[model samples]
Target: MKILDRYLLKTYLITFISVFVILFFIFILQTVWLFISELAGKDLDLMMVIKFLLFASPKLIPMVLPLTVLLSSIMTFGDLAENYEFAAMKSAGVSFQRTLRPLGVFILLLSLCSFFFANNVIPYAEYKFINFRKNIAQVKPALAIAEGQFSDIGSINIKVDKKSGDKGEFLTGVTIHKKSSLGEGAKTVIRSKKGHLISSEDSDLLQLVLMDGYYYEDITPKNYKDREKMPFAKAFFKKYNINIDLSKLNAKEGEDDEITNTHSMLKISDLKYTVDSLTTDYNKEVISVADNLYQRLGVTNYYQVDSINPKKPKTPELTSFLNNKDKFRVLDVASSDALSSKQNLEMNELNFRAKKKDINSHWYSIYEKFIVAYACIFMFFIGAPLGAIIRKGGLGLPIVFAMLIFISFHFLNTFGKKFSQESGITPFLGACLSSIILTPLAIYLTKVAINDNGGVNFDFITEPFRKISNFFLKFNKQQ
Candidate 1:
């Protein structure tokens, strides 16, 4: 390699590594803060905590890697420009584009690596992370219930005012709401002055022992008039025992892949397969529902009307051949059927909308794997050119510029995804929205930098304000 190319690559790599480490550390801290509720007071061992962080760290690459590329590029090129090294290189017949070639190649390789990581490592980590959390709750039943807020476990919601003991197994002021099998909400409520959680490593059940508890069961009477009484069954107990099954939460020694169907846990290929299957199923469901509604509404009977009768009006009015009583009966039945069909259609519409949103989410996830890879190259071009144009270096101005640009990109990306999920736009467009909006800016910066144009000019903006100010001053003098 030429000396100049080696020098530029060395400088860029140093800056990139330093910036990446600092940013990754900061983001890891942010991740911890974000999940502090789940991690804190859980009595997790050091290895478990480290495992949790390690599993979560892969997902942060898409966010951190692009920012690192942008910030490091700006800092490296900005310092070189501020030191007049660019001028020396220019005098030596080295163009700006030549200076970028070495680092650009490095970025291209990095982008490829990012794509592989997103397609393989990230999905695996997401699967492990989620299942790890579930297993934690299973192995340590007390961790499932956080003090002062209700936590849903299995078919019951449990809340406690205070918890004390080695594993927070001793609870005070415990409350439990058992969900009804009939889908009528929580019909049974249990309150205890104190409770204890008992579990064994070998078993898949956690037993709750309550002391001095009251049980209240809401009763619904069959008769409408009797229901107005608002009846309920109440009983007081000195002690009670409830066993919660945790078989679903069990995680084998080295395999925690129990829950793996979420969109984020699927690689691009898996996501494509899921999307295709879901779309086919959705279309088939719509067709089946339409056919069922048509049959239920008796539309076929009209088509079977006698076509051979010459005297029969082609479009005879309803009740033309029926008595008044029969006509009224038919009208009532028709109105009821119409109302029922309307309700059914409305329900099906909501179901279809939810399914469509799920499909869109999967499609967006497929695009996002590619987006993360491309974002590295995208941010590099923006930052490198912008750094040369601005001619400032170090942490002060480059950090501000990097943050502003990245924040805008992140915001637009989020907005587009949300809008697309709601059916406002296609998933491909949503995933590429930020890049589409910012490409022109990168091109402009690169063009101006190549032509030796300095930082962006605000003359057009300032000139108008200056003219308005002068006009106001002259008017004031005349007055």
Candidate 2:
């Protein structure tokens, strides 16, 4: 490599690393802020909180790396341009493209590394993070209960109107719906004016002590003939004590293996496999629905009618054999069949759309692997050239421009992904929409940078108006 290439590459790499660390930390802090409320009162150990953050951090890499690349490129090239190093290089016969060459190669390699990291590391991190969250939830299952919402703990769904006390144990206006274990239409409903939940760390039992409570239990009648008034028992108690088994929560060691089936938890190859399978199933379902609809309508052959003459109009078959009542009945049955068939087809269509959405999500993730990687390449082209063109260095102007550009990129990406998921557009178009939009801008910037004498012409935008004003002035002078 030449000295200039090496120097530029070294500067770019250093800036990129420094900016990446800053961006990564910023993103992590944002993540923590978003989830801090839910995580704070859960009594999670500090190490567990750190582990949660650690597991969650890898997901930010694909986002942070691209932004950092844009910022670093702009800062590096902008500083060089502001320092007149570009002029010196050009005087020494080095073109802007030549200056960009080494950095471009470096960015291309980085993009590839980013792709592999997203493909392999992101899935693992997602899986681990999901399980870690589940494990944390199990750590203090009672903490899952929020005021004004029903929370299911084992067989009982508990709702509390208000909670207070040192550990949020004292509850007011509590309601518990205990589901029946037996296969009977039986349930026990309990309401309390006030309640307190007490649980020990070592014990696999939760004591729910209620004050001024009423309990109602549904009773099944022994005789069917005497069931006109279904029996039920209601009782009021000054104090009610219920023991809840917490063994399940304690025993659950994040056994949610099915969470790995989520689209976020799958690698590209796994996603591809899932997408193919879902597509095949959807196609088969469509064929099956069509066949079922056809068969249910009793249409033997669409083109054939029971007639000797090819062109002869046959009498309507149903009216010929049946009276008006039978005809009406047949019509009613047909209407019902039609409605049923319509419902089935509608359901099938919904399922197909859902599968398609899932496929789109998988494909989106797959495209994202490349999109994020290529973003670095794209951003560099944009940032580097814009920096040189603007002739501004340091954090101030570069940061602003980088933020504006990144926001635009992020917005386009989000809109495209959302539209694709809704089946508004194809996955390929949606996934590549941002890159497609930015590529031209990057090229434009690069072109301007190459042809730029000293700076790009900002007055060209007003030149047409200036010409019109000049024309008006000339006319006025003639007048």
Candidate 3:
């Protein structure tokens, strides 16, 4: 290898590694802060906490790696330009393109690595991370009850305004909703001024003791006409004890083997399989709904009538078909059928929309794997040329430029994904939106760098205004 090539590669690698570590650390801290509530009072051991963070950290790579590439490219090239090393290289007959050759090869390899990581490691980590959370909640039922949010532990949904104690055993302003066995929803509501949670590792029950509470149970009347009254029984109590069964809350052995079916947890091959199945199911459902609605509305009877008599009207008016009394009866029955069909169609439309969104989500996930890989190369082009043109390096200006560019990219990416998920656009377009929007900028920067333009020219914009001002000024002077 030539000395210049080696030198450039070395400088870039050093900067890349340094930037990656710092950024990764910062993101990990952010992750910790984001999930602090889930981890704070859960009494998780050190190993479990580390495992949680470890599983989550892989997901950050798609965010961190591209930014690292951009920042490092800008910093490396910017520093060289600021130090006049680029001038020396230019004088020595080394072109700017030649300087980028070595690092470009490295970036190509890194992109492949990024693709592999996204396709395999990230999905696996997502699966494990999700399962870990579920296991934690099951193993420690107390962790399920977070303060200020309703938490479903088994059949009961419990909410607490405040919790204080060594293990958050003391609760204040407790509200409990017990779901009925008949699937009638939460018919029984319990409100308490204070409550205490008691549980043991060896036992299969969590005991909740409420003090100064009110119990309200909704009563369903036998007569359908009286149901509108919404009668309920209420009673005040000084003390109440409830035993919540924890048999199912105990984490069974090999529970993680049950795969999580979320799109994020699927690799490319799995995603393709899922998308195909979901699409097939969606098409079948649409066909079934259409056929059912066709039958329900009696459209076939009209066709049959037309087949029997060619002269019969295919769509007869209401008055032409029957006498006054018979017409009224038919109209009432038709109205009822139409109303029922409308409701059915509306419900099916919502289901179809939801299913389509799910399919789109899977498609987006597939595209995202490739997107992360390509983003590395994309950011590098933008960063390397931008740094050369700006002639600034280090943490000050490069950081600002990197952040603005990356923030724009991230925003467009998020918007596109969300919009695509809602079926506003195709998944492919959504995944590639940021890249499409920024391609021209990368090209412009590279062109300016190669042509020695120093920076973007504002002459066209300024010269027009200048000429206008001069024309006005000359007219005024002549007058």
Per-model TM-score, in order, reads 0.79, 0.73, 0.76
Compose the digit string of candidate 1's lDDT tens values, residues 132-151.
Answer: 77667656678778889997
Task: Give model 3's TM-score versus the native structure.
Answer: 0.76
Candidate 1 lDDT score at position 122: 95
lDDT of each: 0.87, 0.81, 0.86
Q: Rank the candidates by lDDT, best first.
A: 1, 3, 2
lDDT (tens digit, per residue) of candidate 3 on 393-461: 999678978998999999999999999999999999999999999988888888898878666753564
Whole-structure CA lDDT of model 3: 0.86
The 10 consecutive residues of candidate 3 with the worst lDDT sum are 304-313
In model 3, the runs with Cα more than 4 Å from the true position are 145-261, 301-321, 455-479
Per candidate, the number of residue pairs that clash is: 0, 0, 0
Return the lDDT, model 2, position 64.
92
**Stretches of candidate 2 exceeding 4 Å from the true structure:** 1-3, 139-261, 300-318, 454-479
